[model samples]
Target: MTKTTFTGQRHPAASTEAENSVNKVPTETTMNQGGDSSHLSFQLTSHKLNGKNYLEWAQSVRLAIDGRGKLGHLTGETKKPEPGDPKMNAWRSENSMVIAWLLNSMEAAIGKPYLFLPTARDVWEAVRETYSDVENASQIFELKIKLWKVRQGERGVTIYYNEMVSLWQELDQCYNDEWECPKDSVKAMKKEENERVYLFLAGLNQEFDELRSRILGKNPLPTLRETFSEIRREETRRNVMLKLDSNLEGKNIDSSALVTAKNENDKKKKPWCDLCKKYWHTRETCWKIHGKPPNWKKKGADNRGSQAFQSSSEESGLQPSLEVPPFTKEQLELLHKLLQSQLQTSKLDPSTPTCSFSQTGQGLGEDDWQC
Candidate 1:
């Protein structure tokens, strides 16, 4: 009798076990390779990664994994195949891609030593062990101290809020996991949120004191997100009001300045007359008796005497009347009849001179009479 080694096709009783193994391995291989084509396209960058940013680095790595549809690999839900398994090549390819991306996404100083890691899980675990443990106690302490001392001086509301948010995030990644007991998961989260609200309020500028008090005065304190929103709105409103006020004040100042300048210009253009005690015309250009005659070119004692005489005559209403031309016929007849009637009634002769002016100043001399 010739004995042959067991082959699944020739030995019908062993066919079931062999067939099951064949089906399982190819299914695993197909699943892993199906998404590998897309995963190779997304590359990770080391933008914010430092030795101290393990949490941020880990978060970025997860996002990359999720983008590539490889979250199962990151969570360790998809483990490496055993030796000689048909799916082993596909499993190794998937894990190696993850590991490569992880190394590329880290700072060169922090990643160079870990570049030779055999799997993604190994690299991730090593980083966590280094940066997420007692080894980072000092760094965590520093971050906490900074958070405590942070202030909103000179910074805008959004900028200060963002900085505080960054501090809170880094602090959480450093100590939240280690200190928060697993038993108080939900309660611890709530407490941590409240603490964040208080910390944010405490670091705000004094200008925000009233708003901060309003938030704290609530029976149930507000969330950080809500607090930030309210503060941003208030800051915007304040800025708008200040700008409007400044613009209005600027317009008012400009108007007042223009009025003042016009008044000054008017004063400069007007000429004061000292002789007449009036404005708009100087003494040299005045037309009143107190002013020099415009046509009087010569200056001498005669001109001075004429000016004085003109001024005195004007003051005394003694200006000479116009010369009498030949009398009209009606005026001469009336005067002749008046003379004949006067000759008949009066005793004095017409040829004799008579004084018509009153003696108001001094006794008149014989030659001072006028007819």
Candidate 2:
């Protein structure tokens, strides 16, 4: 018998001839075949049990995928995407999974058409299904609720709920029925208290954040050793409190009201006024304080007169006379003469010529005068 070759390997002569003689074709193994060969045909719109309508299901997913990109190319024989597409950030559903799952949940619940926000269970499950790490995905839902509360404006919530049961009950009742929530009787008072607390907290947080940013923004954040010395230098007197040691306890004076004003004297560049202990530079620049010190006028420059500087500031819409450079004795004398001249000019009759003009005319005879 003559030998036959199969992919360069010799096969039994009789077996190879019988297989190759009739068909002249190659048969591929199950591993080499493409796709889910178990059930070759399928419809995307229908879930396994036909739980969803074909058109609507397809449209929803299409819309969702389209928001991020064209997911149409995903199909059999294709490799599964290794990671999420970055472009989907713009197409984010915000709470798409939550809303979709809610639609299904409500459809089953009331067993009819009903307008309902997604319940917590629906949101949780949807996120769980979408992301392998469910814990991280829950953050998106929380943020969605926050956005919803903000959009509701005056009806926004201030309380946090541990479970969905109470929250959903409130939301469902509010949406479905006419129910009035009791307004906090002490709201205005609470608002003022809250504002003070918030401001204090915010300022404290800002101080820490500024320090944190300065420290952490470097290529490598500072170590304890690098930061400790500077931190001590930055401390205020009260930072290391001079409390009567609680060990020798007496009355604990409330230090709550001990607030200090920032000294912005350098910003105003004004002279310090010991009397007011406020720095708008000096009493002369302290428009809000009113009733100046006896020598306030003596201290300020009379160069252009108060009104002249004040008018200039008004023209520029600036506060009157910002911290001006201090005048020496000679400069002060020159300023005095300058002010007197301005005042005299302001008071002069329109018909009269200036003193310089009148003097020049008197000194020069008509024969000596020329244009």
Going through the candidates in the order shown, the clash numbers are: 0, 1
**TM-score between model 2 and native:** 0.13
Say which candidate scores most in lDDT: 1
Tell me how far the alpha carbon of residue 51 in candidate 1 is from the true structure, in angstroms, after superposition. 3.4
lDDT of 2 by residue, 130-195 (tens): 422223345436533743443212221111111212222222212211223324423433343343
Show the colliding residue pairs in model 2: 270-281
Native-to-model Cα distance after best TM-score fit, residue 318 in candidate 2, in Å: 68
In model 2, which regions exceed 4 Å deviation? 1-111, 114-210, 220-371
Q: Candidate 1, which segments miss by more than 4 Å at Cα?
A: 1-42, 48-53, 82-86, 107-112, 133-135, 176-183, 273-371
Number of the top candidate by TM-score? 1
| Backbone clash pairs in model 1 (N, Cα, C under 3 Å; residues 3+ apart or in different chains), count | 0
Candidate 1 residue 273 Cα shift, in angstroms, is 5.7
Error of 1 at 158 (Å): 0.5
